[model samples]
Target: MKRLMFSVLPLMVGLALGQAVPASIPLTATATLMMPDGEAAGTATFTQAGNGVQVTVQVSGLAAGNHGMHVHEYGRCTPGVDAATNTIVPFGGAGGHFDPGMTGNHDSPQTDNMHGHGGDLPMLVVGADGTGRATFTTDKISLTGENGILKRSLVVHAMPDDYMSDPSGKSGARERCGVIERDSFETRNYPLPGPQDFPEGVAYDAVKDVLYTGSAANGTIYQIDAKTGNVIKFSDGGAQGRNSALGMKVDASGRLWVAGGASGSISILNGDGTPFKTLMTPRTPLPFINDLVLLPDGSAIVTDSSRPTLFQVTPELRVRKWLDLRDTPIEYQPGTNLNGIVALPDGSALLTIQSNTGILWHIDVASQQVTRVMDGLNNGDGLVLTGQTLYVVRNKDGVVSKVMLAADFKSGTLQINEPLRGLRFPATAVLVGDDLVVTQAQLDKRQKGAPETPFQLTRVKRF
Candidate 1:
């Protein structure tokens, strides 16, 4: 048995270097300001102009007076303990002003002195209505080079800058801050062969450099060349005794394992699309096998969405009922119950989601004990787990949620719900290198008899 080692450090490094602004191309960046208590302060935008840059800032919910603003060295805006007083300080993680030139002085924005810090900017004057706006251009800073502001922090101070103070402008305290991010990445789409393919699941074969997508409308499987973006039919659903294919994965031995949706079956095929075997479950309540994950020992754990049950298929192809959650806190609703599943790297436990109830549950493989981790993730259809970061694809919400789980997997924090462009109703995603290729499963449109032509799989980089 081989262990799954997941790490995102290399991917993070690639993204950081990829965001460096090219000298010939125009650049744009933005930041959403947040207050100490997690309130929306405003936004800031930066655009490349000539040899310098143009900056615009708009803010609200502040006292009617001047506020000092600057670009900080770090992109973090979380509260931190103050070293001087041992008290919590808001937005203290942003560190000090951005000073790439090693300058220790703070001067006017119009200053040409080398001692002036590059982060020194004009004051923001708030009106009686608690709103403020500032727009200016300066050659002291740029979108590229040593003084570039990408991946930095924008901060607003409690008091105004006197334009001559050293180190800091005597600007009482840091009131609000936002992390600056580039707006350069775009989603790339690859066309599927069928006009109404309605692909629900996607799996990448790193060994062959190919991608496989299963159709929800029909059980037809399509193979796509990852390098050339060419699509071809791999197997006919009807001929293969499959009604629908919802979730699928490729094991290390080059065998494809597919979860038969509403068919109560699991299909195993060779790398050449040759049928290996098919295992069927009881169809008392009309089982909906939504998704699955391959364990370190070559066995597979599958999720039955219509019931609060999980099925396991051993490496030798023996099938049996694995874990039943009927007596646990997880309830089986009228619609989808347990949809997506992922095993821990250590193969000690598994994390599964309840779509109807929006709850995440952790199950111990050896003990068969279930613990409800968290809720409020309604419509979470498929899940992609890398290290402690989990991505939940919400089909109805048309968004993908990024969550950071604790080391023990008993708790997690919802980071952000990002909406992907051209995502009709994303079903599931597979990580290919640093990109996430998501299936655009327009199930709603398919039921309405008006799905968009030539369904697509969108690739999102650094998601």
Candidate 2:
């Protein structure tokens, strides 16, 4: 009896310790996502609840449709044009969809009772108007544990998951995804902003000498005194529809043209924020217009990240040419979610291929010839040119490289003369007065499970 008691005592003690201490008790760290074409990306925060997690997701610039949201198998997102090549296989290379030795359909009714897999979350549906607000809790897993969530990723599918379907649920494709890793000390400071930092869509028409800034999140687009960021209500539009001013431009005629993304029209605004005219977009399987760049030759170029091509449109928004500008085999980099674009003074245009690899290509506006000018920088987006120098912005490292352009376009040497450091995730930049104003799209990280940062615009003195 003594010997049996001694053996059983150790066994009882071991069991008690195991139950008392959870394996790291994996908790939510951060979660974020990118839009399909890479123009828009947001983050979220998550917290622990009983045995599950509560998540809050707030986003800007999402189309009104059923978007797929799920906790991915890993928590690392490579930002740049070539992110596809930068993806790290899940389970440290174990396989797809965090199974952890379990397998079943996504959100299977029997998931809890059976050997269930990870990577299942409720569907995120946005209205056709492109505005979305969602908050939900999940009982699947956490971010920290022997088999925690940080090792996984949060993904937004291109289509809605049917839930009980096997494999990838005819949910189209993985449109946008963000990583959830341990944030560095500096990264923590740039947490997602609250209701205070929302940007009012600012309209600047060089021809009209006016600027209008509006925020749909707050339901207002202030006609600001162009010299000052003060509100002047020249007009009002309901925020129920897609409220994104995806891209805005002022034509030589002093008219404002904007692609209201989810609203399905190119709206021309007068100096006082009044809608002058609306050109409806054609219905097709192609991606919608997110931005437009006016060319010197009276033509326009727009980016629709969904179709993997650049559409040249007339001022009337009619399609003139379709340029399939996808990266070639020799230049293909992973995670290339093509985004920002600009028309150079020389009549050529530059475009950004977001994520995995950073690259800018010079497209011959007249001949449709494309050539690679810069390679291997930060996540290249938001391009600008001044005199003989070209400026490219990096997303991941938050540094802008000022390169000196040579006389030769084909052989021009790109020298990083100035590196704009000490900023957040700088996505796009514009020439604001004598200063180069840059936008911080916020950290792709998450809190306990709120959404990632929306977008913030900052400036740097060019003196």
Candidate 3:
């Protein structure tokens, strides 16, 4: 492949730049970077840090080397065909580095000075394996009040940026580009009734047309009208266990069972969100009861991350250990043992191991034996089953996988028929009508400032 360097190649490209301050103050802005063919390579999330801002970039599908990445002036990522190489020129219309100050200096972020162009940023370093992560703090940008990068574009060059270059550093072609949207946690298509208490689990009542969500920090249960977006407090943590609610499910009888993440308890609520039964953890002192799936007899099979154990809540609310990771042959991390579960009709359940396994396994809840069902999924958080199909949600990286499970539950095939739509670190989901309502957990473990964002449930069409 030929290079598109300013010194070696002819200069035939021109880019337009613009700047605008958002009318409302936003806490965050995100950019979804894409390749020249308009394929999403990864995401760049900019959040409000201390005085400046923190940009965390997770990218893939690039050549191995240090690629120059910067914020451009335009919000457009228009692609055009190049006459010289007969290849697609990515983000051709996204203007050069933002340069609101017009200092016209290519100052690399590592050695940046105040006099450098505001658009100048640190080089985006990619690895040989096609994935990269670059986290940096910039005092030049803000996601808060005036003159922020609300309407800008992020550009990833084809080559490295030589810090002292006059125009755009000696970076090569614009391989990847994305538009930075000025959206915050507060802004959403759905209306939230009260302050978001950082919810992680969600359950939809198809018969009643109401959606149930719970707070992971306080165990406050919220009920929202699926059609009108009307929200109200259902069950306060006082009546139920006051632990952090993590996973939730409404059984066939309309009873809701909620998993207490850190408190190691399971609380059962009536269809009206009335407290029914509360079962505390067994044996272990520190437990992370993460997710749960209901059996045919209303027994809940819960995944405990820190304990490497599965607790079963019987129909009469008797909680006991149903499975143990140490008893199985599958190798996995202790604390990150399992998350997200789905029960089959034949008394078998599918579970997700978050860390080492990174795959789905079918387990006999009665025997405590597990068999591998599928692999290649990382950080799978939640799964919803409808007939023979399962939709698994990966919380750390927002994406859903549609898997078709066989009738015997012994085999399943994973297919990516279409790319998943709209997800902000989804934690759990429930199918409501034709749309699936997903709860944004906004897990604060990895990202610096995420849990502060308003927790929301996004409804997306299920394929």
Best by TM-score: 1
Worst 10-residue lDDT window for candidate 3 reads 8-17
Per-candidate count of clashing residue pairs (backbone under 3 Å): 0, 51, 0
Give the per-residue lDDT digits (tens) of candidate 3, residues 145-214: 2224654688888788887776677787888888887442222234444454667898878888888888
Point to the candidate with the largest lDDT. Answer: 1
TM-score of each model, paired residue for residue: 0.62, 0.49, 0.61
> What C-alpha lDDT, on a 0 to 100 scale, does residue 85 get in candidate 1?
41
What value of lDDT does candidate 2 attain over all alpha carbons? 0.50
Model 1 regions more than 4 Å off: 1-183
How high is the lDDT of residue 344 in model 1?
92
User: If both were scored by TM-score, which would come out higher, candidate 1 or candidate 2?
Assistant: 1
lDDT of 1: 0.78
- The residue ranges of model 2 lying beyond 4 angstroms of the native Cα positions read 1-226, 232-241, 259-265, 279-288, 326-336, 346-356, 411-422, 443-456
Q: What count of clashes does model 3 give?
A: 0
